[model samples]
Target: MTHKQKPVIGITSGDLNGIGLELIVKTFADARLLDICTPVIFANNKAVNFYRKTISESNFSFFHTREFEKINPKQVTIFNCWEEEVNITPGTLNETGGRYAVTSLEMAINALKEKKIDGLVTAPIHKTNVQSEQFSYTGHTPYLKASFNAKDVVMMMCAENMRVALVTEHVPISEVAKQITAEAILSKLAIIHSSLQQDFGISKPRIAVLGLNPHAGDEGLVGNEEQTIIAPAVKQARNRNILAFGPYSADAFFARGQYEKFDAVLAMYHDQGLIPFKSLAQGEGVNYTAGLEIVRTSPDHGVAFDIAGKGRADGGSFLQAVYTCADIIGQRAEYGEQRANPLRKVSPEVVSRLEDEKIEE
Candidate 1:
């Protein structure tokens, strides 16, 4: 039997005009990354060269190949998804950018599905530009959920100190409340718990649930969603043996640094979780999609159109994303191996007989 010591990670060149390629080039400039995983960039040679030239200071280069078998483990490989030269106008928003971004993502996803790649690290895409008749989703999370036919998925933000999972992502504030049901919270909690244990190697995960209303509804005075909706969901989760607590006031929880006490925090909405996470992440946060059959991670930030081609884009989050993807791949393998064969429990009678036999011997 043989196993690959290094995982193959597929990187998508996000928008042609965005900082995605810059981040990719900057992150891989160290060359040490190839030691952990074989890097495959799903983009044309033109795009790769464009970014490489734009960031002239970077000495990073890639092995261009259209064939998967020719992928080099010791160097970066550019898997040409398209040969047509694209007009890459950095820091610009247009339909062309969106369309090309989708193309790159689709190619990477196909490779992931075929097991050609062990994990995926997607670059950020503009939610508006990427939308078309074929791709109508808001962002990567829902798109991935539908792509893999995943029953559910949570957009979990991971940083050095804390992990935060959103209950409702990319939804308007008014619609957020309507979507916050007991079932929704429980579903997210279950996914978060499983992800913590499986993807993160937490044996027993503790999840802190954030409240929807101010002061957690102030004990039903401010709002009752906390009492009627959230509290019940926590109880149901506990009944199912999940260590889920709170419906805690969001402001207080993060302000008091209570998130440090738990394995992960589940917020009622996007801003509730992300605002604090981005502030705390300090430019090194990775957005991981949990409950997927495959590993997918991206930089916590979006396509910084302002800093796209200026070579000022920070690669910290993207670098962390790569690390996180490889780590989860390894963790899942270890977790699977741990559960592959369980020790059979000995009966009390067998134990007593064994003890007696041992004494006689």
Candidate 2:
């Protein structure tokens, strides 16, 4: 495929019984999406058809094929990963849901590795059900980290107003403090820094670090994590020429609308970042996995078990996930091109003269 061709995005049907397919169907129903990126859903035709019935308004249709060469840019494609007839119980958690979710993900990742898909956009999955011998990780971030052998990956929740990256993801509240080290902070910072530049096209991104305690530890009265751990990490980041600041109180930070001032914010843990991000996102939040070899994005929300087959699942976040995935792919390509043939640094005198020179129309 040429660089000018539309990117092929692999979509994983999360838990079959959940809102995963619902979101996918609703988002792709708008045929205009096919114009930007061709979607290759890694799922069984039966399963997709099952969910398609739930969403009455969905006009989503697809070509059924197992071959990547058969993929059509103008049509949605269902890359059949399995042909077995399985029971799909919407809003119910079962082993079948977990098994098929894993199957869909495995096939999609394989396609991604084989370069059949340009990027990946995953729907939500049940954490407990999707665990076994092959998939033992707590969530997608860790699973993907191990899948690609990445040293580390940052779970960044993105929206229009602000972007938030978590320092510790899916860890217990008790173990959260134990995991907050300077090295971990710096590692996440590096990923977020590079991601901002390459994925989001931010030239000089400003990052804000949130405290691990209330009122930023109140100068050691509430806790010393801000002083000893988070603050020092911020300082170390600054020394590395990263524009990182603060061990600011998380509550005051969002309450005061301080996040709008920076390009991204690095929160200490999952809830610290997500709670505020989801609140501000207005259903358009995208969960992006940074520091990975391949582009992957997902809706910030999880599987809605209660409203799975109700046709009430909002596709805003899922649509944004697709949009963000395609955007980052383009951004990475442009960033790569710029890096390959970067402009030479000019002298200050020459720059001044060029700025002062008048151009003829």
Candidate 3:
């Protein structure tokens, strides 16, 4: 956790047919990135070489390892999880690509739980194809929540300026309204508040909660969720000493630059938050699974299957994910230290008593 001793960051090569490996290789190609953290990729050497050659990125290479202890700090390492021959068909969706993506993710998660890696930065995975008996979740947030046995977790998408957390994820738009309740809104608010403090190191995070309906239900003209569900939840959160406010109309909140006034924003659903975040982030956003004991992050974008093998996929988001993971690890370490030995604030009466005692002495 020191400046000289870098944290080991584990990267999961997403679907083989996707741009996972390409981003991994391109991100690590910069030698200066090694100064912050040691990267250990969960992928086979064959797959790595395949992508390297396909992208004409010969300068990129990784140290092959079968054991965690064998990872090299000065160079990037690729831990081989599978050796079976599989066709590396880019821009195609198949079960084989999904299976290997799961394999790489499983291995990386094991390493993370074993303390071999400090944090995890995952690549994009084809959610539908990656579905299997072992993995039955909708996305990474839920999977990680179950993996760590965390009771509640928030899917927070972050950039330099804007940070947005979702109340409902991976659910259909029709089911979204049904899922929006006072309890659900309150739970997400609590998680978002706690995560902003612990994970991002915010002392008193100001969170803006977006309404479920348009114009925040037009004051209950369009929908009653704002009054019966979201507004009540905001009131309850405020009563509980959480710095939460507003069942703000989503459109005006962003349009008026009101998001910048708060530490974080909680959206009611997926597109409500992601659309604005992606548009404003300019391809530098990171999807962070907050409220978990361990740190996990991924690029905000999904697997670019259309442009998978053309060597045209942008690595900016993936690189930002890596840097964001490292930064959160450091921030959490510092937060822990501060929590262990917090500075005491002396009241005026206590200070007067101390002064009197000093005078008597």
Candidate 4:
């Protein structure tokens, strides 16, 4: 499919005072990236212009639009939030910036739910500054679930050929034990499996499930979650004909490139998956919110408060987010074409898995 035929992605300007605006402004300035997908930014025109001028970016035009139905991808489209003007200072943090940042996200989410756009590409928002009473939940994943009536969601960071999904997210290190359950692991694996097939279009995507304890609990001597919780879940997923197996020692899994054998690796916790993911990915990775009714992705990095307003802030991750969304939209469109052809039929196993998931639900 051509870029124009691809889904229109709604880009959320995360925080006014942070690099969200700067990155969005700089990335969109590149007209060539438009070939991937047309982007609509949920942002303030004045704030965007103010930041662009500060950064000395003059190539892009921010076209303001009140009605989402009037979005034109050929131009830089803006959904007017139009809150009170704030100074576009580089490297500064304020509640005003935070409030405006989240407003953009909320607006974009509404547009996604209404099918105003195909996918959501969010810029980084300062977790501390951009949150308000109306916007609750620790971060975007939870926020997405609450807004869309989704039961469970996964956080997967993607860079090049590598994708990592976290089984336990945002929970404290101390509570990892209590939260680790066979059912939870099984459910997460199922979610990842479905996401890989439907969104990623991976046929029989292989998954490597990470062990909870170090060295897989040193063969159940040091810890037992590996044997007690993780192993059983892996077994159950296998029984369902899902190609999943693990509880591999986290240290060995990433070290030996064991992760390369699978489409995705299920990390036991946040840092367990993210440290390696970011180390390899850095500024180039995109954080994808999996299992949403609409596609959503953001830069893997968070709000760089220390360099909030600095022109030095990198736009690589944000650019990657946009490109990733574009690729997925293209892939989904390809699936549409395949479905249209009467000669190709979906395999029986694929159809059965879909039915089984619905029954489980």
Candidate 5:
């Protein structure tokens, strides 16, 4: 692709003590990847070099640039967010690693706000270590939502075939029952529907919503959430012309492979959706934050401190995250173009004029 055609993807080096930089370096080692998009890594020189040398990937080189105008499309570039030297100890979690991780992420987000990057591909970050005075959020989805001031967002885990979205994320399992309300379900459905149409290029998306209770309440035998809250939400969504259905029993729905018939699935809580997504995605899935103005994706897995410096981390999911971000950018652009100026109906007089002109020719 040409420079103009290639999207500028900003990559954040997640927890320095984790496998964030390793995956970033490994994915960009392939020279052919530069042909698709320009990747700007948000990391200091010390952190980049530590991972490069530890991984023994000497062939991977990047240009240092503070300004986006100096970005080299034909090569990988590191945007220096910090210049100070920091200790790099793999498999260890500390406050410094979390602080630097937030620094890198904040810089990339600012660049995205300024239109310096087309999309963002964030690596894994330790949810606990990354919390501080400036950064205090459950995870990336909530943080990104608050950063962009978005009213609602969907934590959609997507793979090649299956796509699962969550209505409640990073919330306590005990509170899951109390949180399952008609208003919340309806809001998530709206976000999912709009995201499917604009971000995934689905004109009429068919959404499958999962039930909160076992057996979908077994018709009030086990619970009443399915009938009282979920059913009403589905009705409201349908009234808005959204192609939504279900209060389906989660287990039977996936066991019977019913998810294959829908464009997307909306689970009532995090584990209800993520357990199946991770199991089925098989390390090839991406966690995409839908309903944001800008596209953001991350590897479905978290910071694997166990394999941090062992050079044993797989780059498949991270690579897929980058590709997914690029794909969403392209999809949104195409969707916008189609929505901008739809095909106009031709009049009979214009049709006759065209016929007469063709006959004369």
Candidate 6:
């Protein structure tokens, strides 16, 4: 089949007032994207209708189906959740809009679980707006883990030349220092290694790890996470044939294209990795959840409530997210047909079983 005829990409319309809808329209306007993959927006038909009236772009065609077997790559589909005529004024965050943002995610996640879509490309979701007792787990990575029952998962953010994995996320700076365990480090390293090889097609991946404090704590002058935790993790990973090194200081690590020297970097917390990533990427990064059974991706930036609907939301970030999702789906489809989600088949208990067999041999 041709590129456009590949598979339908499920995109969740994040917040009605945010730039998600605008970017969706803008991104698909480029006819070249239609040559790659068709977007299956998991949102209401009325929302698209309103956006078309406001923006005057009416290229959206819908494909409605309750089952996975009806998904066709030829049509840009819309699975409407609620038909209440939504008044989507750009840049305004309301509770009603937030409710829509969440329902879109729930439906898309369900679609991914049922293998209805090739991959999930979520728009930016407002944390305050995403309501539900079950949705109370940090960000998308943790939410995906909770949905998939994955105990250990890592967040890897990537641009063209650089990718960085997170060791800790969505925690206070004070609490991050206390959360690093040897087991946690090793598990993240293993996941990073496997992901690099499997998804990125890297044979032997190299990872550079960052320190928790400034100056890497100046050799234990200010803090000791380097000596106490990070260093041990690095050594363990290296012993396992994973090239992991450095408790590098975060701010100074990005000089003269240093990120190109390694396949991925493991940051101690959120800002340490993303601050540099966003700076280097300049609103072109793809936020990827690495430890999921099914591939999950989103635009690196949050809902740009500031620049919502002035016809100014750039489609570059959203385009990148779709491209990354399609690339992953294509790669994995070569290995296992219809088994796009690994979480359904691969469990930690399964890993333990394989390891036991090797030991017995």
C-alpha positional error of residue 298 in candidate 4 after TM-score superposition, expressed in Å: 0.3
Where does the lowest 10-residue lDDT sum fall in candidate 4? 335-344
Off by over 4 Å in 1: 1-4, 343-361
* Tens digit of per-residue lDDT, candidate 2, span 262-359: 99999999999999999999999999999999999999989899999889998999999999999899888878877875632557787667667744
Question: Of the candidates shown, which would achieve the greatest lDDT relative to the real structure?
Answer: 2
Q: Write the per-residue lDDT of candidate 5 for residues 107-127, one digit (tens) a residue.
A: 999999999999999988999
- Residue 205, model 4, lDDT: 91
lDDT of 3 by residue, 270-341 (tens): 999999999989999999998888889999998899999888889999999999999989888877777774
Q: TM-score of each candidate?
A: 0.94, 0.94, 0.94, 0.91, 0.94, 0.87
Q: Please, what's the RMSD in Å of model 3?
A: 3.2
Worst 10 residues of 2 by lDDT: 352-361
Q: After superposition, how far is residue 143 of candidate 3 from its true place, in Å?
A: 0.9
Q: For model 5, give the RMSD to the true fold.
A: 3.5
lDDT of each: 0.92, 0.92, 0.90, 0.82, 0.90, 0.80
Higher-TM-score candidate of 2 and 5: 2
- The alpha-carbon root-mean-square deviation between model 4 and the true structure, to one decimal in Å, is 5.8
- Off-target runs (Cα >4 Å) in candidate 6 are 1-5, 56-70, 335-361
TM-score for model 1?
Answer: 0.94
lDDT of 1 by residue, 1-361 (tens): 0123789999999988899999999999889998888899998888888888878679798889889999988999999988876898999999988998999899999998899999999998999989889999999989999999999999999999999999999989989999999999999999999999989989899999999999999989988999899999999999999999998999989999999999999999999999999999999999999999999999998899999988899899999999999999988887776677332245778877987999999
C-alpha positional error of residue 136 in candidate 3 after TM-score superposition, expressed in Å: 1.2
Off by over 4 Å in 3: 1-4, 344-361
lDDT of 6 by residue, 1-361 (tens): 2123476788999898898887777676565666577678888877865665556554645666455566666666677777667778778878777888888888988877876776889888787767567567556777889888987888999999899888888889889878887788889999988888777777799999888889788999988988988899899999999999888887778765667899999988889899889888877899998878888889998888998777677778898999998887776654353245344456889878887999999
Query: Clash number for every model?
Result: 0, 0, 0, 4, 0, 2
